[model samples]
Target: MTDTPTSRATLDQVGASVTGFFQDLGCELLEYSPDRAVVALTLAPRHLNNAGNLHGGVTATLMDVAMGLCGTWTEQPEQRRVAITLSMNVNFSAPAAADSRVRAVARCRSGGHKTFMASCDLLDESDRLIAFGEGVFQRGALRSELP
Candidate 1:
């Protein structure tokens, strides 16, 4: 894949381009800062599992995206970069039914030159915790950056 750096003026545009699937899943970038990020998605029929509730994978994805951005948002807006997930652990605490507006809030708990650790909590519209996740990410350039 080609890597194109994003400018601050186009953060939202770039965010959408990088994770189009999140958009397809009805996820939006609710808030972002150097240390934290919040993302939300409204549960729909397409987001449900056979049990008729939110799918575990969907929650995991939301957490992953939130935490990953927690690290990415640390970079200068003029510099385009991506966070590679080195490891991630997710726990589904409760089932979220369809039509629920779930939000994933994540923060970069710790970090160093090459790697960073982030944690996330998935909450329903009512602000109840539904899932939790943490991930180790490696800071890197997009493949397109390679000569």
Candidate 2:
């Protein structure tokens, strides 16, 4: 069977529960699906380091959020899947200035019933590569069944 496209409303709710840290970090879910996930954030004074550029930790967090959610993509809000990062790696290729709009796109590369691997690319509005990450995640309970 062909893959069905997930709705925008369903996609927006993708990380509502498990993304507290990312949401608190000012990241917003732009798009989410089994094939790809997009997340974005705007840099603020608090997001910078002593040198006044984007902090590396923030970059990594964005990548992690994107990668983690991509594998858990589900069209059903009640049946949403959840996964935890088993291993992750991030590489920074450039620095983002204050107020830059950063976006991350992640896609699942391979997977099984128990685990999946994904990759993410963090970029600025101009599409400059800021950083990228890859991770292996273990599947967990569904959101509705998480109690």
Q: List model 2 lDDT by residue over 1-147, tens digit each.
A: 126666666655655655567868978888776658898999998889999999998888889888888888765677877888899999999999999999999999999888999999999999999998799999777768532
lDDT of 1 by residue, 12-121 (tens): 74456455567778788776677777888888899999999999888888998889888876344445467889999998888999889999999999999789999999
Candidate 2 local Cα displacement, residue 122, angstroms: 0.4
Residue pairs that clash (backbone atoms under 3 angstroms), model 2: none
TM-score: which candidate is best? 2
TM-score of each: 0.84, 0.90
Candidate 1 Cα lDDT to native: 0.80
RMSD of each: 5.6, 2.1
Top candidate by lDDT: 2
Clashing pairs in 1: none
